[model samples]
Target chain A: MNRQFLLNLRRGFLVTVCFFVLLGIAYPLAVTGIGQAFFSSQANGSLTKNGSTLIGQQWNGPKWFQGRPDADDPMATGGTNLGPRSKTLVKDVKEQIALLKKERITPTPDLVTTSGSGVDADIAPVDAYAQVNAVAKARGLSVAAVRHLVSTQIHPAQFGFLGSPYVDVLQLNEALRTLR
Target chain B: MGFTWTIVAMIVVLAIAWRFLGAYMVSVYEGRTRWLSYIERPIYKIAGIDPDAEQSWQRYGASLIIFSGVMLLVGYMLLRLQGHLPLNPQHLPDVGPALSWNTIVSFVTNTNWQSYSGETTMSYLSQMGTLALQNFLSAAVGIAVAVALIRGFARKNSKTIGNFWVDVIRTTLYILLPIAFIVAIIFIAQGAIQTLAGPAHIHDLLNGVRQTIPRGPVASQETIKQLGTNGGGFFNANGAMPFENPTGLTNFLSMALILCIPVSLTYVFGKMVGHIRQGAAVLAVMVIIFGSWLAIGAVAEHQANPAVAAAGLSHQPTGNMEGKEVRFGDTSSAFYNITSTQTSTGSVDSANDSYTPMGGFAAMTGMMLGEVSPGGVGSGLYTILLFAIITVFIGGLMVGRTPEYLGKKIQAREVKLAAFGVLVMPITVLILTAVAVSVHAGRAGPLNAGPHGFSEILYTFTSVTNNNGSAFAGLSSNTAFYNIIETVGLLLGRFAIMVPVLALAGGLAAKNVVPASLGTFRTDKPMFIGLLIGVIMVVGALTFFPAVSLGPIVEQLSHGKFF
Candidate 1:
């Protein structure tokens, strides 16, 4: 019984060692070599560049386009941590609304609503008609015109199944940039 | 347009390949042919560690502790040397001392709770020599523990479990390495970067601007990183970069690789234990849970927002493609969400923060459940075993017999140990998240506005404590306080469960194999499977339901009512 246990132990040990060296060391080396040979750019770190200066990767979203009011500092990329009900959020949203009016751009619902991160301090579209009217007047557009644009542009439910209609601020900004 | 179907087809093919190809490899390793003997001989000689030595569980446990401690020291030193390191042409700044220690402990534990950004803090040397090495070994440790557990079941009255060093080495070399290599080659072919040099040659785009693509040895680390379900990325953006996940195919493949080993190990467990059906039952439960999450994520992503519709944009019935790789599209993004969260692999092709509220909730819940849908390579399977034990015990109780799993009686000791292993993370995650939110340091990092903002903090804690390294990205987690708190989470999340799992293995090893009889309750039956699934759900619900209600559920309800 003792001999059998020892033999089994040896076998288990051998198998485990063999498995590790092959999987851990040799395998990683081989894969690294292969990756080096072919997918050199991506295998490195899919870094994006603008001339000699390195821009962020395309996959990482840029914070600048969503307006100056609640945009995160590019250096930090961190949130301000203000909840929707916080007085700070309300104050920031009002200031952003006033700033949008100064730009003469119609305040889209996305611009006024809070996004996933509370830092941008945007106002939600679900706010009453009065607020929409207030935002529209601030932006020098009629409430009806802003409403029509929002209604036309916002996304609806998926296959009519999930999620409510919402606008993406970045995309809206892209559209605004193209407007004559 | 057909990107979604292409992704689905790719996933199916990869799954099939892993099932068959992995089996063939294991069989080859197990065979005693003289020609194949040469392959493993050199590895045995170089390490100066005997491959054929037997070890008691105590020795195995000791080696695990010692090796992990050494790795932690090495990883910490590597981070400190980053600015002056050979591969750091970018001359990235050195990591802060406190954050470096936290990161080292995180990866050593295989919790991988990175408080520092990958692109900014780590040079190529740190990424390869330290972070990537830890990714491999930590995964090996997980596989080692799993093998020990299997031995406990397979042996009738074994005095020894297995050698920890040997298990770690073999698991890395034989299993993780080969798969990672092939996957890396494929990824490079799909435009993943692989280099030791700085920026590659510049190319002018149609817009008349120059774009110099940065290059590195990403494909190599990426392969094992995903395969091991070690979610640390070479870049801050993670797999979202075109270089890391250039095409839809690579996205699909990465997702498959993350899950492949964990899933195949189920078959391996069955083989080792001489009970294939038992493995299949566990696989079924995993598949069901994964499939449900995938469906929910897809539907939630696909649903066009009413606000977007109001703005006159075309609602693509396909899904919300915002902040997602257009090359991969929505279906693939949704699939990525499910796989990444389910497996504790944090690589992402899309911005999870951009996911819709309910969609984000599904991902968060997947992490909070401990990502045990075949969790991170080694740890995932063991956690599932904990579930299986709980499941089998309940099954036995229902049938009016003392519970037995794989010929070993499931006694109070086993139950208590397994339960402790399974419950530790949920407790730590929820409690820490509550404390963080209430404290000044924790509540200070929200980049977005609303309840979803709060969810980000909660999600970070959940991901860290569960060893599922993905973040909501909106939280500023690079602070000293977050670094310390999350590192503690990472430590407790890993060691707390691992020690208990090892103890359980020791307990099981001492037991005699019981014979199957007329009164023996078959664990493979649907009734038992249902019971097991119920136990998992009930335990999960009981542990995390209140936390969930406060974070995602409340946010979702508030969004629905207010919006």
Candidate 2:
């Protein structure tokens, strides 16, 4: 309202504009450019042959090795966030158990549980192993052969202890394509 | 054992970083180093700012407010115009009025709470121009205020703190930008997405479906989101998504980045106050509290999820894998989230709402402690100091001696300002929670039922008021009522305390150091550290015990205890 206030506003406006250009625009663009130059695959999205994603997708039927239960919308991905004592969590888990029962598969916790992001990329190695027999029987393949495929796809936690050992469903199922 | 190793590694890395970063900040604030003067000078000129000119605390506060206000306005404009903007590969529409108001206020205050799922909502231009931009500036603003407060202790009878413009500029250029750049590259190499392109569509025949996966300049924003303690994620899953945090090393690095400045500023405090021990005492207090909570949380999450157990699927060895990524496992997720919550870097690698009730309790309590266990970049340092002031006051009363800290006499004005600053967040959280629970709009927000439902609401208000930005991920909070009400909480939570803190800095700046007597309270000693921790806990417990009891505590009791 006064000259001092006016001066402050002017100064504030100019500085804000400066930062917007320098930090907001220039900095991110530079990072993007550098990322594209060096790590092009990662920067653009880690896609493999035939447009396979790094993450797992919804796999249904007894023949396909299913990933974890997932949300349909990847664009609006987030956790189910069911509390420890919620009726919703109880009901969902029960429904998942019944589905696994129909498929005649051993129920693994990861198989039943939804992820933080609806589109989780990997499942626990145990989760993968639980499906080996079910898929093997459904596909008329030897259980040993399907189990070996699952074994080959297991990615140990980085540095043996950094994260959890897991299998990428995309890689595992792709390996399954090679089996008799 | 690996989880234990993580604790040990964090200790060593943060200890090393604490000293170096602390010293670097000392140099940056003292104007002893002009590492990037080539660009800094031009920026100052462009903005009509005189770098050498000093500002009284009032002027400094006013400048900060005006600048933040301007940023909010511009950011809002960007969000509203996202559909019209250039980088809309997904072609997302513009944000609505109430959500935009909530969002800009959230970012401007350094809270980063998202009522909207980011990947579906924010365009590439909006991500870079608005969200990522604020991540740098708001964090820089935090560091500036913190350094200003450090100067309040460092200077003797000074009429001014430092130039707000110069401080903001130097922090962005010298501190945040370079680190963010280097780490952005590292994030990219570690598989974080960073491109101008839009979503990647994959036609995999697994389900005979076409998947449109979102991608953008994620690595660019992800680095600063952690480094600046701005935990706004590129994807809605935040740290959990493989594209955002693909490896264990990146997760460890993010944990380091989140704690980096908050931990170092204590050293800066010590160096500025001419007593290094003073900073160590504060750091020791932070470590004790942070470590305990991390252990409790890790142990709690290591147990099988009861929901998993109920489904007869608890045979799997990885404890509580529900709503958690396989890469991080349950224990590692607990570690990352505890670090995130403690530092006010609220990025999540797992669904916090699905944690064993105690695990959620641990995360919630960290924010409830005013996030002073080495909190968000700048806010952490000052809030802890507020605790120290109160500790000294209470300690002085117990001994019947006049209180002094860093040679400055503690009086009524300083005490009142400190008390007001300390109480602002909790009081606002309580009031907002009460209002939200009573109304249908608030009650309908939580996705879960019973006590957990109550927690979703409590956690939302607490996260907003504290400016910690992490949510329970269970609240349907995009409604107009929450948007408008939370904007009020965000503003009051941020500015209300900040004004008083600056006033205190001015008051402290005016005081002359009184020579220490035998009876003078020794704030740099072990006793002070113990009392400081005591003060923080007592304050937190007294304020939030009833509210928490209704949420996590009651949920825990209803389910029976793991311990």
Candidate 3:
């Protein structure tokens, strides 16, 4: 029994190390290397840079369209797990509505409700259009031009069947920068 | 709305996969599949294992333990040395020791209960190399154990069950790999990212601030994450992240992959035992429980938050959408949350913590019910079979006859082994949860106050104990205290129950078959299926009722609901 146990242990160790080399090291590296060769932009973080530093831009001012509310920590990401009935959520929504009213823009449901990921990169087309007048005013552009820009930024549902239509906030903001 | 249609679409897809995948699995296990012999031969030769040679349950169990132990060691080494590894473009540091232990045990046991954020903590090397690799092996191990148990029932007075090495190899090479590769391709096509590039620096042109967007080979990891029932996410946001699951189709596919093997293995069980209805009976029980939980969760999630109703703001027609993806909406997200927990695949496409109190209960209770509503990949099959054995034992006692399941007589030893397997999880979860709540470190973990806070701690232990990896996501569980305790919970949760399960297989394998007669209880019938369901429900409720009551139940009640 002892002899068999030792032999089994030896076999186990050897096989595990061997399998690890095949699976843990070689396989992942090969796939990733192949991926890099074929899909460089995605593999390298779909980045469109301005200047040098990585961007953590929050679009609070009227010059750019706002995305989903982000978590407090810039590096961190999560949803606001506020129950619909919670006073905190209601207060926040009411405050958002009041602010939108001040800007003479009606708040869309998407604008006030936090997304599953607080770092949502897109907003519904309606939400995007709601901010057009303010963005037009801030950028010294015509409302028709800003609306046209929003129309250009609108992305159809993924593959035409998966999600609703939306505009990518980053892409929209990039267009805003180009306008300037 | 799209919510109801998504659920209908899911059922149709699952039903198709069930018939095809189930039949295919039967062929794979029976060695009737001809496509993979060449690859299988080389593997057996290199491992020095005789594919045809059967192993006594003792040797089989020992092999499983030793294999897992060695893999755990290899994984730990890779994680600790990840900083120096080649694929780490982010140059992340080595993991802390306790978290390392926790992670290694988590994946090795098929728990995959990630306490750390994947993008921040794991490099591409650790994510692909260590975590994803274990996803396949650990799931293979689970199926191997389950297959051994089925073999125990099939063989008549046999000295051996089956070869563990052969089972594991065939499961990975033929079953998991081909499917994962194909699914990975589909995911990539659907915009799920697959790349090796470092985190990209993006300048937010609007705010003039710089943001670094983290990216990696996510599609490849995502496939196995769902397919292997290993729920460790490529990102901390898990399947909810657009990168991990890009669209509605991916969401549907992810849910299907999580459940495919587990559901099909029931058919494999029937084919092995020479009775297809036996598989149907188990399948029915799984569907009934799973369907009921999904229904309750959907209804609860679809209702307006009572507090939201009280707030008197105009609410959207769609039900509570607070923490759910806009693409999937309420019903689909609720269904996914319940399914993930029930199957022991912890990947959440929605924030389960933000679910209504009743919806959260439905999710928690699924885990608390031992996750055998088509449980984790292979673990579900064996665990549920154990319950069936007990059910037969009970039926026998009531009718004044000897208990027989699939023609194998249930003896005193079989009963004890099954009971031990069933009882260990609750004991471990309850005891650990009590200890956690009493300690200062544990108290500091929950982010919420009141019963919801209690649910966070409770959900953590329950998820770990059942080897179900989903969490409430409201707990700060990254500290050394949680890591150590959760590790202990995961290890015991896996091997404590696993060891006895193998022992039961051995016991069953040694028993002489008694042919079914009119006096013999028919386990493949609807009545038997009902009885089996009752046994499972009673055991789950009895074992977990108090703790659950203290957590989700009271939380829901406090919110003014009876159920």
TM-score of the candidate numbered 3? Answer: 0.92
Per prediction, fnat is 0.15, 0.75, 0.34
* DockQ, prediction 1: 0.11
Expressed as tens digits, the lDDT of each residue in B197-247 for candidate 3 is: 666666544476666667788887888889989898888778777777766
Model 3 residue B143 distance off true place after TM-score fit, in angstroms: 0.6
Instruction: List, for all models, the DockQ compared with the true complex.
Output: 0.11, 0.63, 0.36
Candidate 2 lDDT, A45-157, residue by residue in tens: 77875343556687767888888898746677788888777666767888999998888878887888888777777888888888888999999999999998888888886
List RMSD in Å for every model shown. 8.3, 1.8, 3.2
Each candidate's lDDT (Cα)?
0.65, 0.86, 0.79
* Candidate 1 deviant stretches above 4 angstroms: A1-180, B1-11, B14-18, B21-43, B200-214, B305-318, B560-563
Q: For residue B148, give model 3's deviation from the true position in Å.
A: 0.5
Quote the positional error of residue B87 for candidate 2 in Å.
Answer: 1.6
Candidate 2 segments whose C-alpha is farther than 4 A from its true place: A50-52, B560-563
For model 3 chain B, give the 10-residue run with minimal summed lDDT: B305-314
Instruction: Give the number of the best model, judged by lDDT.
Output: 2
Query: For residue B389, what is the lDDT in candidate 2?
Result: 93
* lDDT winner, 1 or 2: 2
TM-score of each: 0.78, 0.98, 0.92
Give the lDDT ranking, best first: 2, 3, 1
